[model samples]
Target: MQIIKAVYINEMFKISKKKKICTSLIFLLLSVIVAAIVVYSLNNFAGVSVTGSSEFSVMVLTILSYSLFPLFTAFICIDMFAGEFADHTIKFTLTGPASRLNVFLGKILAIATFIASNLIVVAVLSFLFSLFLNGGISNPLRIIISYIMAFLPIFIFALTVVLISNFSRGTTSAFMFSIFVFLVFVGLSVAFPQIKSFLFTSSFDWYKLILGSYINVGKIFRIFLILLGYGLMLFAAGYYLFEKKDI
Candidate 1:
């Protein structure tokens, strides 16, 4: 397992060095720059007297960092496993001592780690600029917690892509299903709140989820539990299919 993890981690670095990763990072940096400009300019123009925490600003930054950024990451994740198998590199890894189950898990972890790290970078950048533009960090801990919490759904969404990638018979099939799965999730997020749940992401974005105000601890716990459950369920299925695969 350790060797599998190390190899996967090394491969993750190689993937990160790819041109697409550079492009993606550039895109994220641009978003952050634009977001910062908007926040800074708005603060100066509105003359809203820098006083306490800029809850509104925090929320906006959260959306940029967690939601938009993670969505961008998903496009590349779909191609990760599928692309490997498409060119037959996956077979080389599969034939190694590590079971397909480990490969699947490691790949999922690699994706999750990549995304989580990206979110953390956003949080750091957002915090630095936020302090200067907003003039106060009323509760530093709260802002940080909110940023971390905002990425949970995205992490779950990414893992779903990994699972989908495994079941795909070929890269084309994986690509097609990836699109379907991505759209379905986005649609669910958009439509889930209309029926009953106020907790759905459709009702509120990252800003509303975080710095907009204080969410109850109970609600936070529930959200974490639900996401954790969903992530585990998807991973369990991925493992089941992988273990049974002829490869």
Candidate 2:
């Protein structure tokens, strides 16, 4: 436990020093600003009265989750795993007292932490912007729940990226492969609606299941179980590859 904690802190410190972290923040902020601008333009020029703060926040969340969130998650996972392996810097950590499993867990935890922080920032910024524009938010609790629930599917996506990174020999290859797999899954989900519920990609909008007025607990629980299964399997496979790889 202590070893994992130490490695988690060290990984976070390393991530903090990377320019990618700053770039992610800038991208998120720009996304919110762009969304706000679009809303403003639509209301003034197009004569569209978009006056729901909660709705605006949901719009931003949906866009980010489907686009930037997965891209950044892949970037971070590749850098942490594949990049380290390619650069041969992973040897330094492997030589330490901590076991490979501990190191892997720590890095995974760090990535999860950074992603959660990014989501929180996006939620806060979008909410504040919407509040300023629309005067007040309706159903703040639902918006909050939507953002919170988003983390689960995103984290599961991270696990998939981690597994991909383990199979990659370099950062570039890892990133390319991750994106290809992501697109493939998305395409598959669209091509075959029957199997959509089983795909992790379909769960990206899992939050919406709760957002609707109906609130089907059975469906939500089923999806949650699917995500949990994917996460566990991916984590185990990633760790197995990492353990066997020559660092």
lDDT of 1 at 141: 77
Off by over 4 Å in 2: 49-54
TM-score of 2: 0.97
TM-score of each: 0.80, 0.97
| Local distance difference test, candidate 2 | 0.90
Off by over 4 Å in 1: 46-53, 65-67, 169-176, 188-214, 244-247
Model 1, 14-93: lDDT tens digits are 57777877777677667767777876676689865432345534555546643565556556666667677667776777
In every candidate, how many clashes are there?
Answer: 1, 0
lDDT of each: 0.65, 0.90
Candidate 2 lowest-lDDT run of ten: 47-56
lDDT of 2 by residue, 81-108 (tens): 9999999999989999999999999999
